[model samples]
Target: MNPRLKHLVVALSLSLLAAVFTPAHSADTKKADAAAVVQLQQRMDAAEKHYRDAMLAEDEDAAATATTSALAEMKAVVDACTKQRGCAVDTMLTTYERLLKATPQFDDGMPAADEDPLDERDFTAANVPDTANAASLLSEDGQRFVKMVQFNPAVQAGIRRWLTDMRPSLMDSYENYRYMQAQMAPAFKQHGLPEALLFGIMAKESNGKVHVGSRAGAVGPLQFMPATGRRFGLGNDGSGFDTRYDPKASADAAAQYLSERMAQLNNSIELSLAGYNGGEGRALRVFRDTGGRSFWDPDVYNQFPAETKDYVPMVIAAAWLFLHPKEYGIRWPSVSSRPSTITLAQPASLYELTICLGNWGSRDGYLRALRNLNPRWAADDMLPAGTSLNATFRISWLYRFNCAHGQRMALAKQLMASNVQSALVRVGEPTPAGSPQVAVATPAPSAAAAVPERKPAKPVKARHYKVKRGDTMSEIVRKFDCDLGDLAQANKLRKPRYALKPGQSLKLEGCKG
Candidate 1:
């Protein structure tokens, strides 16, 4: 044993014995002992430092030995503290936290500070338990989910779709889910549900976009209806923020809902999924009517609506692909998603932060990650300084080095402050030669200044716009930020289908900018 570790063991043993045998002590004596406990904490820190050094030096033998010594020391410290009076155990827990922070990236054969932690790994080391080999990296529940897959023609067809045209969506869902895995996966795990199942449901429902809403009135990554969401405690929290749009809360509700369905539906995943998509009442009725037959039984399957029929197989296929992406020649993007946070040094919006972050070490910017992690804030909402934003380790790091007091930061600020209305020029306005085209709003005259009589400004008239190729009425309305009814009325376009053809002329009214 190392001399420092041996000293830690002896100190802990003496402390435990004293705590057990001694009946009482003065306040001063207790305070003195607490101080001694604090001193003992240094040993654990030293052990961690040794472990980190060994890992950094690529001495696996030394690193393994240090790990064993450190864990034993931690256990002993915890044990002694439980018995020892006035031994502030928080000191010990903080030491353990530091060890955890250091240990996660090292177990994957990389240095703690330098490695991204997501490259060529199933999950962060902290997430996977007792992972002896690469194949065992999937949590026990994940393996169970893989075994549950029935691989029928519907699932096979779904898999073919995922591998072909839908491949981009599959990749995007994986990337989005990875960032939110820390927030969402644990709920399913706590309910003894599979993490892959959560991913599958999220992928099929919203492609892991938390704010996504369906035309059918379903919302969030899980696509819960308003009634179902309210049942699962996912509605408004009274501050106007819908909890369904919240990843962690929605995932918890989803897990609980699934657990209830599993209990009522005889633990049948397919039937539970059908209930989730079609209707729980319908699913229960079908199951009871079929004498608890397999979901594949035509009697049970035919009862579900066409949408539910397609939904179940697609979700299953996505889950299958999530677990076996490599088997089908699909290489998912490597994402660094270790949970971290950043306290804003100055007010900024997600859009500004995304611009400043500038896609460093990512194919796309961090806007999606920011939105998914901090769901309450809109992309363009400027969060105040000292606001703590949930982020990834890599993103926080980028914010520190790239986003603080840089040219890119200034540019981001400038871009967000700009207004498109300032750039617009009326069709009949005279062009002034040698005048700068930039439109600057003049400041209003001071209240105390002598005011001159001013003529009333003319009301701006409707502008004429030509219909372009491939332009739909809805698209044109959205592009011009026009009210649909007002736009239709101004252009004399028909109701319901306000159709348009190429090269047609129309008046742009009820539009801003």
Candidate 2:
């Protein structure tokens, strides 16, 4: 061959060789990518199935375990993908999106021990687990739980978008969770109630909201209804402590109350839960009429109210989630074991502590720790000498002025008390809407009134509005910004939600009020 032709021929051969290898390498990459996609898809499906099972289960511990297992697997797949050089994690992302959109919503409103499941099963009044419920499999493993639940690409993306579009409070304060937990151990310990049990209770009771209250009059971190609370050592302490609002005191009371209920109800968590909500007298009465069988018996379980039936499972479900977060794919929460609260000899104010700490942030975590430790602190509490505080004391972090819990409590005894009353329920006296209100009178001259026989400043016309079926007088007043008391007076209606006939007319008097 000619020299030029030979060189060109060699170049052509080299180019051909490079082209031949390209497809082979591409095939290898594609095969790996395809496998990765399959794995991601499998993980997403598993996560969904596990979460559903956990939610319906009444055995929270079991549910939690299952949830943890589910998430652990999911995380393994994700971790592998993260390591892949040419990974198209988009499939994982897509799977997440598909599942989040496809799966049924778990909790749109706050969760509660008495809340009904999204779906019911073979469970019936006759067959429902006496206190059965559900939880997710992803809840078991901490890492998997976070990937599947908290940071699931699809669900989290959607959650982020939804939250951005409509502002709402989704994040929480550990203070509320801790307060609930602290209260649980002390109170239940006396009655042989397990400390771990508190996590489930607090999760369901208030979703960790300290200032929570139900329309039925339940209040505080534990959702103790006023009447029930008063009966169970939860209210009106001699020292001006409303036990319902006092974490330590209330927890102590709750433990005692739960123990009594459990024993009275034959040591059945299901039956005890029923008693907690449906009233002990009623639950027992129902059981008495029946064969007095176990809670899991459909016949025995059905004896309780709908709320009671639902309550048992929810508690168990929440507990399961706590124990096995992997099943639901929630984040691996590494909460330090809550420290024991040590009491001081004298009261110390939070403000004083903050000041004494020297340059603590107004909303710093340390201050939050103080509040969590002593939830009963009113704005003006004189954290009395011997007052208890929950803390993880570390002298190396910051010391000198701040002593160990014991010494600090002793010093606090000399400080003036705080103003706790000022810290009473932030949400108070719900205002009713859409009721008629009377306006303050701007009286015209008496002489002018006499001339026109007092054409009484547009003799406020009483307008007639139909009362919706669920309408409450308070609701009506709130809608209309009317005084509830005035609405009752004007309507001469005895009942606050005066059995409004659909065509009922609510008369607003004076100046078209």
- In terms of TM-score, the best-performing candidate is 1
lDDT scores of the candidates, listed in order: 0.76, 0.50
Q: Number of backbone collisions per candidate, in order? A: 0, 95
Q: Model 2, which residues run further than 4 Å from truth?
A: 1-183, 294-303, 327-332, 336-369, 379-513
Return the TM-score for each candidate structure: 0.63, 0.39
Over 251-312, each residue of candidate 1 has an lDDT whose tens digit, in order, gives 99999999998999989999999999999999999999999998999999999999999999
- The TM-score of candidate 1 is 0.63
**Candidate 2 worst ten-residue window by lDDT:** 392-401
